[model samples]
Target: MSDSSPLPPVRLHPEAELARDALSTPLLSRAARLARWAGPDTRVDAGGGLVDEQLPAAAELLGLTGDAAAAHAAEAWRVAVDTGLVEVTDEEAGTVAAGEDLPLLTGGSPHDILAVWLAALEAVLADATVPDLDDLAEAMDESGEIDFSRLDWDPESEAAFLDGVLGNLYLLTVTEDGPGDGPVPLPALAASMIVPGDLGEPTNDMLEQISDAMMRLDDQFRLLEPIGLVAYQPVDEALMGDPEEEPAAPLDETDVSRYGMVRLTPLGLYGLRARLLEAGFGAPAVGDLVDKGADALLDGSSGYGPLAARAETQQWLDRREPLAAARELLAAARGSDEGAPLRRLRCQQALSLVGAQAEPAVRDVLDDPELGGLARVWLSELGAADVPPPSADLVYWLTIDTLAAQLAAEGNSEELQTLLEGLAQQHSGFFAAAWRVGHPATADVLEAMGRLHPDKRIAKEARKAAFKARSQQGG
Candidate 1:
């Protein structure tokens, strides 16, 4: 008998560090019980998500009821999936089993349950809740053009879409609820989702967007909260006014508006960040940059989105003594090769933060070619030296480096294949040359593309470049 099975994921897991706090222990235990009750071969209906068959049992087990009982039931089932208790699958596909190796919850240790959930969570996240998140993450590698209009609203990508909506919620939260911060009001979170406040005052249109966002939130929470990805106070049906029967035909409406507050559970954060990190995106918080050297700091910040990079850059600078920071900045800038000019400029910006103390280093580098223009500009800004016209190559290198950083940080292989192909179209010969360039992480990044790309030809090309780089280094 011949049994053909696909290989397990290699690079994505083992790097995932699941966090189990006091609150998560019980949820994880319940999740384990849910999985155990379902058995190892729980079968989902053929044409839908795993929630269909398990909701009632899950809802009852979780002691959930009310107008939101079904949602809670679905969420608990999802938690069982996310926490490694229940695996989502089609009974007919035989590709996956809804109950693969899941143990019954009777006296199951928290550590063991958490361990199982961690492994399953990585797999689920690897196969993103948002199916086209591959393309979406790739789009972020550049101007981050999100064609929200094209998002698949089907159950498959609903979770991933929810993750994006959550991001908008997260941005609204940072000031008040920075990483590891607590919950914000549901109204505020939903409002932020509709109008990020980017365009000044909110308008009526935003209300519609908020309502839409809430509907989506309701859908997500029904499946997510029971499993514990989110914790919130469900909408109080009692708050609404009694139905007004008028002389005219009455309007029938079901108020699905959600309220109270919601935030990612510790487990949710770990799972999402793991997906981002695996795809080469920057998911680190500001604290990760504290105490790092200027070069390392800039390198780390390079992959972060504009807002986070700026915040992280400030935090990095704030931690250092001015004179010492300036010296380190200049040293880092001087070390930047043509391969990474943006890093040099970022270092220069950090130097400027050091005030007049940075003047001496600027003076010392004034005679150097690659850095002289920047040096003179910093000095000139302070009325100490003449500013030279900016160097063309410096600007060019910066542009390319910026693109490379974004590409490496966020572009998945499909995007990588296109980006590399586009670069090849522009440069006379690029794939071969890319490995030689000073862009940090190029070789490793290319290797990741090689492994994940959908097209064999592009995958082979990426592999070739990675090999060439390694060979050149060894030589």
Candidate 2:
């Protein structure tokens, strides 16, 4: 995802709801439990982790029982310390207490609870970058220090790779054409980072790199799941046993899940969006324009997909009376700027959601030079009584405006090509009069029609009309 362009707006759950989810995540819940369990008796090591002797008690307190229970408890304790859910009061004494953020989990607002969760997410993400326990053990030297060369890890690069993977996952979840809330295959996700866009076929080296990346992602996603960042299906153990083994049969779509599948949880979306915005990415959310004016709503959502735009418009409309909202939209749609046609198109869509209560507002604009044609269409669509017929000039102006909006929204699209062909076929004299329409987009629309029309004769006529229109405008 490019940081330059805004991301598709995510529809986040309410903060209070997300806070409840945050409090419910295993990692944060465990950390919170350990925080409340700590008191004067709780002792910590120099690193602020629970001392080994106290790990059993801490694990028991959290009802964890397994060979790895102590390790889990220790992991939660580290998160608590790092996120200030527990604080080391005296470093030399190695004493600990419930930190300042602990109370926020219970008594503070939903925002406060989410703030602590975000901190925990950060800590966990940092840990995910580190090699697993066995890898660390191998990297350790006789002097008990980690040999950086043996580790073969660059901290900055590892963090960046993970960030890129999560960013792509977030993009997939929020984009209209992407698999929103669906589990993406792990191989495909890894390939998104490894494969060049223009590459036709993957070589052995590229496939091997993707396989390695998948294994790393499997481990990272496992760590992330406990913190509620992803719902992961780990790579099948059978697939990992031997890198050179051949399958009995070719893999099919039905068996793809064995490779692995992952989806971002709703809570995860909220967390990642917050992180993206903090990193200076233009990550927008659906209800962001609810409090803004109609002009802002139309302008802001001009780039949104159909479903998202409708959702945003509905939220904006929910706040005001129908008649007033309709009037405001029409007023905002009457601009001569470059973006005006698309804005007007968005306005028409927004007004469609309004009820008959807005009929007066639509009727009131029937005489407006810029908006009259649009108002007539709306009224006619609603079967409003006594709608007046539009003049030839009004019809031609509306045609240019509509075509301009379509071109802006879907540049050189096949559907627009079909529309241009049908219009030319229906009206033999269209170009002759279209060049005279007073709309700002008249010449541009004619030129687009000329370029897109497949018939040479019609294309020539359109080009001629475009030249006439441009000359008439003294441009």
Reference-based TM-score, model 2 = 0.95
lDDT of 2 at 417: 99
Model 1 TM-score, 2 decimals:
0.42
- Per-residue lDDT tens digits for candidate 1, residues 1-475, read 0013211111111222333342244445555556656644455554323445566666677677787676645544555565545555545652234454464333346555445655545433433344344556644534667665555446545554555665554443332225334665655667765576677877898877775666556545544553345666665544333645342433334433335557776555545444545546544555566677877877766545545556666777787777777777776765434335556656666666677877877777766655666676678787874555655544433334544444544555455566655654565445665677544455665676577656687778878987887777673
> Per-residue lDDT for 1-475 in model 2, tens only?
7789999999999999999999999999999999999999889988898899999999999999989999999999999999999999999989988898899999999999999999999999999999888989999899999887998799999999999999999999999989998999999999989999899998899999999999999999999999999999999777765548876655554688999999999999999999999999999999999999999999999889899999999999999989899999999999888899999999999989996878899899899998899999988989888999999898998899999999988899999999999999999999989998877788899899889999999999999999999999889
Error of 1 at 30 (Å): 1.4
Clashing pairs in 1: 40-99, 75-223, 75-227, 79-227, 83-117
Candidate 1: where is the Cα deviation over 4 Å?
A: 1-18, 22-27, 34-161, 173-182, 192-206, 215-219, 236-238, 243-259, 277-281, 285-294, 302-330, 335-475
What's the TM-score of every candidate structure?
A: 0.42, 0.95
lDDT of 1 at 323: 71
Candidate 2 wrongly placed segments (more than 4 Å): 243-254
Of candidate 1, the 10-residue stretch with the lowest lDDT total is: 1-10
